[model samples]
Target: MNKLKFFVAALLMIVAGTASAQKTGYISVEQVISLMPETTRIDSLLRKYQSDSLNPQFTYMVQEYNRKDSMVSTKDSVKLSAQVKNQIRQELEGYAYQIQNWQQITQQALQGKQQELLEPIYRKVEAAIQGTAKENGYAYVLNREALIVVPPADDLLPLVAKKLNLKVPAAGAPAAAAAPRR
Candidate 1:
């Protein structure tokens, strides 16, 4: 009777172990953005904005115009003799002031919009990640980008990226921004 009881207990333990070992849980940190369309759209908009801001040819033209305008002085008749030069200088200065004001307004607007757009989306993503982890019965999760808590080797970035159709480079590789080419 004792041997039969022991055998039954051991069989139950094996069944329990097998059932609990089949987990459908994994971490997804960096690829969360790729899976989200809104995030991708916003990212593209920001990249275009940044590229427009760094326009080199336009920058050179603005600098050259400013240099010529600064060399003009209304108080000195010799330098201001050409009515055309005076007119050009006045127009350039006015345009420059307008551009400066426009840039300031645009910068403020971008800041407000970025906060408005990113904060809510970030909160939603965080909640979804937490819920997903809980639902899938994850025992542990760690961000591939911030592999500080969980064992680094257990990072699931590749899996998540593959699922989301995004690319996640290996560690020590330069980030997209730091990469030499766009």
Candidate 2:
């Protein structure tokens, strides 16, 4: 009976020790990315891509649509064959459809451009987070936004930011506000 009791105590102690050794931490990855200097450059590049590439394409599409519309409207329909008129009408409809959906199209283009530009920055931040976790003995790192209540010292933002050579905002400051809107 004494041996049984000793064995049970040993098993409980081992379980407690294993549980205590596992460390978990939390960080706001968006906050870290916002603090990164690369993010500002990415924002600038996206703006430039919009103005330089997307805006001109939109303008050209509108101009082409208007020109086609004007040509169809001014031409004499009585002199034209039914087949020719139908073809022109179909073409005009296509243009109108593109113009109507331009916002969604442009939004998708901008999102793709932003993703391309941000990919490397994301990789860098991920590496820093992984390295920090490994160096600091964190078994799991949770997104800070996912947690309702967290232990103060277990916040890994400062450590991760430091690992990335970025400055963290002072306590009580809204770090999320610095993040760029997607």
Candidate 3:
């Protein structure tokens, strides 16, 4: 009974100490990358990839081919028209498939590259954040980005940057968009 009472007293003291400790700051994963130079480059590269005029050109070519195909089929060019129409249809479908595959490949490439580029830096930042919290006697250092209901005053992006020795980018920094294969 005496040992049980002692353990209970110790546990209560520990909880009380924890409850009274101070907490440091928070930042979002998005904000973290925005501050990094590599992320900016990645954004720029992807934008150029997705904006080529291939779609419009493909549509125009397909339409022109179909019109000629109908004309040739209507008179005495039946066999040739069938071959031309089939070829045009195949080309149009091929372009569509290429677009779908490009989208998937681009997404995968960016994700993999981003993870590779950011892993070491993220680890360093995480360690620095924990050290800051412990040194400052913070009871809980929460990620406001992960939480839906952080108080506005508790948004700690600036504090986290300061502690981690990282600079936040100025407003309107352009992100890179890599060009996808045509």
Which predicted model would earn the best TM-score?
Answer: 2
What does each candidate score in C-alpha RMSD? 11.7, 3.0, 7.4
In lDDT terms, how accurate is model 3?
0.60
Candidate 2 Cα errors over 4 Å, as ranges: 1-16, 76-81, 173-177
What lDDT would each prediction earn against the true structure? 0.59, 0.85, 0.60
Candidate 1 Cα misplacement greater than 4 A, ranges: 1-26, 47-116, 148-182
Q: Which ten residues in a row have the lowest lDDT in candidate 3?
A: 173-182
TM-score of 2: 0.85
Best by lDDT: 2
C-alpha RMSD of candidate 3: 7.4
Using lDDT, rank the candidates from best to worst: 2, 3, 1
Candidate 2, 41-97: lDDT as tens digits: 888888899899988988988898887677667756567777887887898898788
lDDT of 1 by residue, 68-151 (tens): 666574455365658867777777877577566766756665666566667765676566656655655665565554443555
TM-score per candidate, chains pooled: 0.38, 0.85, 0.49
TM-score, model 3 to reference: 0.49
